[model samples]
Target: MKPKLLTLSLVSAITPITLLAEDVTTLPTITVEGERLPEPGISREKPEDMVGTPADAGDFLRDIPGVSGTRMGGHGIDPIIRGQSQTQLNILLDGAYVHGGCPNRMDPPTAYSPVETYDSVTVIKGSQTVIYGGGGSGGTVLFERKTPRLTEDKFIRGQVGGGYTTNSGTKELFGDVTAGSTQGFARGIIEYRDADNYEDGSGNETRSAHTSQTGNLILGYTPNDKTRLELGLEANRTEDVLYSGAGMDSPQADNDTIRLKYENQWGTKADVYYSDVEHVMDNYSLRSLTAPMKMRVPSKSKTQGGRISHNLLMDNEMEWTMGFDYQHNNRDANRFAGPPNMPTPTMLQSIMWPDVDLTQIGMFGEMQMPVRDIHILKMGLRYDRVTSEANRAGQAAMGGVTPNRLYQQYYGKNADVVDENNIGGFI
Candidate 1:
């Protein structure tokens, strides 16, 4: 026996967070399993909570009980959020409705919202929050940056990391540097994302790979413990080649987005926010070089909006949130023949997406009641006012065909001051 007492070796391989979670933590107000705080009120946590990217954010929300959204390219999943699309759910960025020019759903709202930038995402399942404006007509999603904690003294901290995707064989880099003092703080970040098209596990191309870039600047000042002020400017840009299953020729496309926001909270975290967003799509193009002839489908669209919200932390524990917003859309479209349809040399009409403009304002409110730490009762109300305009030649102004006036037509049948509501519970 080789000195039985001398032959002793101990090796430990434990992650920092794992070790932390194992010790000295009995009750955590907000568990950071990496942004996965499940339905806390009677709603246990789930795996979908941790999917971080914008492309995957909706998947998490959809998997939540009583929630679902449409899927495309295996990414940019747009949630139905209780049977609602587009304008129904108020998918907000810094509290403003962000609208992209792509009518084909190629680049959904989240496309302009690079998910990695936000610290936390809150989904108001139904008409739970009053401030989401037009998009929230369906529901409201709040993607917010983490506010710096009011520590006793000055401190400096930061995190940096990168990842690689097997599907697209793409590499991405993103992170942040945070420096602070007792009075205030500032942080900034730049992210570059690019990847060739990804092939599904079956080795079949998904036609969903694109290059994306985002940059954000954040500033904050907490003069005192009860008051916090925050300002942030963010941008998301992406480009890709669209390959339609029906069309042979591929069309290259691009989108540009900008968002600015200011937020402040009163006593006990009563939230107030004001934000503005601008989005521009260079052009939505598709190939016309088909069996019939050579052609080109080309168009351009732009949208801009502003929004505001105020929250009241009532004694009843009804986390009440309310707000308003407006949006404008401008479009121009045409079909140019260089390939197919050349025989008659068909002229792409502007009718498909006519020159349509709309402005919407709405008021909404929501409150939740916690029942025995096992049941959650939530209710909401919303009132919307819309103003629509179709230029006599709004179509001609943008070289479009006859006016489509989609929402306007719907409102024509339904009228302004639309009333919308939502109710649900999870235990």
Candidate 2:
């Protein structure tokens, strides 16, 4: 057995800690640019900042420069960009497409979107991007609502908002609640708006008044950091919508929508959505019988669409995307017109739209690369096949309807119930 003992010496070294403090008289100046003019025709705005700012969605779009709205009454104004509207412009709500049931431009796509509920509004000036959808000859408008990401262990959040306007005697109330944890989340929203007939500056009241109510529920599942799936449902109701241009007022409109979305870490995403709208308009609902004639129109629209896209990255400076999208919209409208204060006459019943159906399928590819330190290059290509068809024959006041006569008399000689196939591409 051997035992060893060692001696230890302790040495101390002086170390100086320099506490440097210099008297500073001036601070570095930082110049910040807050607002700049948008692109020639494109514009973007945060809906929260513009709350209680406009009368309706149409008015909201008009706030952007170069955008104008055709104001026919107190609400549901049609937005026109540069000089085009209707089919010329493409509009989307939360990436879903919706077409109005009105044929006389009384209810455009914008009519269904309660701008207050959206998070942001983006206006694409022209047919520059074929990524969203086709038929953007005039422009594209996107209203998006971003879902909240739950990153905390536990959280409960809510928002409540309300506003009023005097000109149209309008009132609005909105509320939202979201409670969730890190793995999953659930959110719900409710909104209501009502307005009375608005008078002009001259105190002449117009037949423009409306009431709307909407509710939404969304459920999100995030199993991991790289995968997510969401399901959403929404319902909307609008009553007593008076139109100055049309001969009737919308007495009732009920709309419902369902959406499902999935995304993965591989940069692949898919979205599917479906919407149905039922609308009824009649003169007697909000107006007295005029011109010794009473009219009523009932319409319906159904829409469904989906898209699948994948993003690819090559090296660090180049990127590419390819996707395919399909959308189908069908509209049916009929009118009943008769003498006032008398039994409804058979002669006045007529087919207005006669089941018009529009289908569009498109494929698109795009690439982006940095050309230089000061500039970037981007290019996209899209091909779309569109089909528009409708029943041509209708019941006339006098009698005997013919498809050839209806076609040649209104549009052209070869105008039948089915239109020619249309195929086009854009870059």
Candidate 3:
């Protein structure tokens, strides 16, 4: 009986194996195609598609490879890329340059950039081209807006979004709308953000509270399928910005920008822009006074720039571009002192930035040729004439010493006027 039971068990197992071997299936072959790789040392992103909500351009940049930021407070992060920062990195907003008003860099250029409004952000990690501007040894950042396309069926489009962060009590609201026909279009964008002091893992609160608002409008006219003209106006205001790493808090930081652009299918492009900034910082506005006298600093900066370029495509598939650009930046800052309980500062303590001006005019040419299916040969040349001046360098300060005299005493060089000629290229 035991031998018969064993034989039956073995037959059952063998029967199941035979049935499985007889049953067979086939699957169709599949092929997947991924996106093409981007050019070397260049990265681009769409703000709306980013993983998380970023407070500003600097905050968004920190998420990129080889990029980091200096956190001052709840907002206004200063971006650092590959161990270089500040003037080494050139930042452009819709092809316009916006210089910050804070001398200590509490409000770097990225601070004025509202991430939600821009369509695209491009980062060039190294000196790869000579078209944007000069002295970008570290890299260049471009925040750009694309032309809105509308048809007879879809003449209007818009989007709105809001978010909240529980840990930091941060609230954000942003929206944009576009209305157009086949001939013209008008677009508007608005954003608001508010944040309170945040706590760390230990539940200790940090000094980082701020409020910001931004608005922008763009009008575009498409004369034909190949030509377009656009005008843009933008404003940004921030208040009661607290900083833990600094001695003062920014009570007001405002920016206004205007730009006009022209483009055609012939690869011709031209743009002119102007940006103005006003920043005010005080020791008593958002925090308790630590010194005997209250201190405040008010600063202003203005930047005007323009560029024109034309691209030529050869029969051999090579592209050549030639352009000229000019920029002028002016800045002034003053410090004031008063009693701790004073409602407003009264005494002029010092002339921190005494009407400084920097101007640059440059001409550049570049050519790109395909070296095969996978490689490209690129080269460029640029020349710039820069002029710098301290208009009020002889003005008296708190200690009755002139800024020019201090410069002479410290560096043994005159600070009144300086000029430089720079020539650069890349391969």
Find the candidate with the highest TM-score and give its number.
3
Give candidate 1's TM-score: 0.67
The residue-by-residue lDDT of candidate 1 on 94-170, one tens digit each, is: 55445554455554566656556667667766544454553454567776676565465646777666667776767
| C-alpha positional error of residue 82 in candidate 2 after TM-score superposition, expressed in Å | 2.0
Sort by TM-score, best first: what order?
3, 2, 1
Candidate 1's C-alpha runs over 4 A off are 1-56, 59-75, 134-138, 150-154, 244-288, 291-348, 365-379, 392-401, 404-427
CA lDDT, every model vs. true structure:
0.55, 0.78, 0.92
| Top candidate when judged by lDDT against the true structure | 3
By descending lDDT, how would the candidates be arranged?
3, 2, 1
lDDT string, candidate 2, 123-173, tens digits: 987766677877678899998776667777546787899988888889999
> What is every candidate's alpha-carbon RMSD to the true fold?
13.0, 11.6, 7.3
The segments of candidate 3 whose C-alpha lies over 4 angstroms from its true place after superposition are 1-32
Provide the lowest-lDDT 10-residue window in model 1. Answer: 275-284
Candidate 2 Cα misplacement greater than 4 A, ranges = 1-41, 224-226, 342-348, 391-398, 402-404, 414-427
Clashes of 3: 0
